[model samples]
Every structure is written in structure tokens, then in C-alpha cells.
Target: METAQNQQQAVCGKEALDLLNCVAQSPYDQEKCVALLQSLRQCVLNKKVKKFSLAEPHKEQADSSMIWSKTETWKWSTKLSH
Candidate 1:
């Protein structure tokens, strides 16, 4: 049982890593990379590593919102100072 579990983990890791490499190689292929990332996320969930949450529908949206908010705050601060 332990060996089987280890093998499954190894396979999942390999698949995720391969997808990452694909994204790295084709940086301009945004759609493909996003699909790969979603697949990787699904793989992790299948391994019971995380729980599904509606708060984070897409990986990019979650990260971009934080970044956008920070940029907006900085802009406001700069304007206030000027």
C-alpha cells in the first residue's frame, strides 16, 4: 500500500512538473499554459492535497487581483503625496 501511494505521488509530481516545463517553453501560449495549470491543480486535488474553494476560481485571477489592488493603493498614495 505504501509503495502504491508513493508511486501515485511520484506520477502526479512528474505530470505537474512536465506541465510547468511546457509553460516555460511556450511562454506566449497563455491559453495552453492556463489549461496546463488547471490540470495540475486538478491533479493536486485528486491527490487530496487541497480542498476546492470558490473564492479562487482561477489561479491568475487570484494573483492579479492582489497585484492590481497593491498598484492602485500605491497610485493613490503617490497622488496624495503630490
Candidate 2:
């Protein structure tokens, strides 16, 4: 499912700022909204491009370089032939 943030163009970072403002004034969900805004801010500071811009697709060059391994492969003797 696409989040409201992921569905938009990230126009001038306005959506993020708007979320923060809304959270400040919110009654029932103020904590949740504030937490999300803080998390967004932290992601950007961490240089986490994936979290920074969810709408953008992954770059093939970067994706191709990453190595992934499932935990079962290392713990168990079983290995798929194909």
C-alpha cells in the first residue's frame, strides 16, 4: 500500500512539513503524527535515500551491488539445487 507521502511528488518538501503542522494541532493522533515527522527528519539526516524518497524506483547499479542471504541458508544444511 502506498502512503500519502509516497503517492505525491514530494513537492518542495511541503507534504512533510504539513504533516508536522497537522500533528501539532491534532487531538487524538498528535503523538503518532509527531513521531512520524521526527522519523522522516531522522531518515533524511541519516542519508537513507530509500526512506527519503519512497516514490522513486531503486537504481539498478546500486541494487545489483547489494548481497542478500537468508538466515536458514547459513543455519541449516539444506540448499536448493535450482
Q: What lDDT does each candidate get?
A: 0.43, 0.40
Candidate 2 wrongly placed segments (more than 4 Å)? 1-8, 11-18, 24-28, 48-82
Query: What would the C-alpha RMSD of candidate 1 be, to one decimal place?
Result: 15.6
At residue 21, give the lDDT of candidate 1. Answer: 67
Predicted structure with the largest lDDT when compared to the true one: 1
Question: For model 2, how does the per-residue alpha-carbon lDDT over 1-82 read when each residue is reduced to its tens digit?
Answer: 9785344323224435556456656375877777767765664455433332222223332212211123321111111122
Query: Against the hidden true structure, what lDDT does model 1 obtain?
Result: 0.43
**Candidate 1 structure, TM-score to reference:** 0.42
Per-candidate TM equals 0.42, 0.28
Q: Write the per-residue lDDT of candidate 1 for residues 17-75, one digit (tens) a residue.
A: 55656766744787877888888677766665432222233233211211112223211
Q: After superposition, how far is residue 53 of candidate 1 from its true place, in Å?
A: 22
Alpha-carbon error at 46 in model 1, in Å?
A: 1.2
Which residue pairs does candidate 2 place in steric collision? none
